[model samples]
Target: MSLIHCPECGNEVSTEAVACPNCGRPLAAPAPTIQRRVIVAEPRDDGFPKWVIAPIAILGIVVIFLLIAITRNNEDEANRTVNVNLATQRRTAEPRDAARDTSPPNRIDVPSSSTTVNPPAPPPSAPAPSYPSSTTTVPPSSAQTVPVDRASVVIDAKIATGAGAIQSVKNEKFYLLDKDLDAILADADLEPIEGNSLADSFGLAVLYPDRYGDFRRDALAAISKHIKYNATTGGDGRAAIKNVEPDSYYLFGITKAKNAFAVWSAPVSITAGENKLNLQPARLNEIAN
Candidate 1:
């Protein structure tokens, strides 16, 4: 059972006794078993101060947001530092990449500090040498010296000549047969034969003038077997003789015989009025026979 105190006067009261027995004031009927509560102050319906509560909540939210922003900023700063480091490393390695492409001799050393960037000077290029590209002409194979038993002569018969028969002869296909017109005419004390066929092959005849007397006539007449000379035309009655030296007259016949013919050979020099010739043994036999 619960006990209750009297409300009017200082007294003890049972939860079942509502009135005070001592006071007997009116002895209100025994109060009910339920105790009545006393009302001292009325309850108010007002809330906490708006200004203080709003600022505190706002401050808490701001503190959480600032922590997140600081964490993100730190992360971004770390990434930027890494990127910068990587770029610096790439820049430092650029020279090594170029050196690998170049030759070993052309490679240059790098400085120890990577922060100091520099471009190296280019290497010198090798010089090119100049050379000849033109060709030299070689001499003919047959332009060498060789022993000869006979002489060869080319007669251009288009010109004129006066002799027994101007003919060209071959000395074993080696040397050319030639004579000296000045010397021959001077020794004989005769004028140079006009229209002489020294180079003519045909259409003209050569005659020995009587300037050297019978000795010259005999010397020429003793020869025979005269062949006609021609450059490209066929041989006619005329023959071409070559003038090699002025002191010599080439003989065309073996002996002085009428209607006898002989190929012309190189002339030899002789004293004035001299009739003998220093001829090859084969030629001498041919002339004598």
Candidate 2:
């Protein structure tokens, strides 16, 4: 029986009163009681606290990363070692048997390494050299290299006089031409004098003044500016040609006379030694103007 305030009038109602007596109003119904509830958590079987899960998960991830890095580093080191071995093999001068070459030197070999590899005991030791034939049996000039790069030439030239007299040509230049003398003098318009003999025509042609200056100029121009060798005759008409290589060449010279000229074209093969040539007025020797 709880006391309550009246709704219609300001009055205190007693324990068993159904209505308020002072205000003649019925009392309001009693208010229901509000109950408080207490809730309890369920127990966990795992002993670890919940706050430690984040740090444990983070530490596990770091350990996994470290293991992965270590594995990758080991793999990279192995790969580098393999690559270095391959580079070493490539730099080798010759292909070697890998198993045989890598073995330790002290390893046992059948039949002994020296017995199989060494040349048959060279008759204990020869009284002579082991080569037996080379050191003592040497040839005299077999190995000496004699240079044949140059040779020499000597020539005697003469022009026929009118009265069947042969005299020495003076101040005449004789050229050693590699090309054919016929080819060189082809462009020159030199008309040979008609006679029974080349010596007779040559003697008769020298009576007049010089008429062969143009032919001489044309012949010199055809042989080019490079002359291998040339020599001028003294008063005796003898010239010595030096430093000529050992080859076939033509000894070409033009002797000027009053009205005619004589040409010497001798195809001579030069050797390592001295060579001599004579240029007298002849039909077979001239073979041309």
Best by TM-score: 2
Backbone clashes in model 2, listed as residue pairs: 208-258, 208-259, 209-258
> In model 2, how large is the Cα lDDT of residue 114?
10
- On residues 1-289, what C-alpha lDDT tens digit does candidate 1 reach at each position? 7665666675776656656776643334554598799989988857876778889999999999999999999999999999999999888767655543342211111111111111112226422222221222221121222112222232221111124233322221111223332233344444322332221111012211222235334333322122222122123212222322223334322211222212234543322211122222221111111
lDDT of 2 by residue, 1-289 (tens): 5777777787888856878999888776567799999989888778878999999999999999999999999999999999999999676623433432443322111110011111112334333211111112111121122233455566666765556677876677777877755555443444434422322233222322133234434545766543568877776776776666888776666554433445565566776544566665422122212
Error of 2 at 201 (Å): 15
Q: If candidate 1 were superposed on the true structure by all CA atoms, what would the RMSD be?
A: 41.6
Query: How many clashes does the backbone of model 1 have?
Result: 43
Top lDDT prediction, candidate number:
2
TM value for model 1: 0.20
By summed lDDT, the worst window of 10 consecutive residues in model 1 runs over 108-117
What's the lDDT for candidate 2? 0.53
Residue 260 miss distance in model 1 (angstroms) = 92
lDDT value, candidate 1, whole model: 0.33
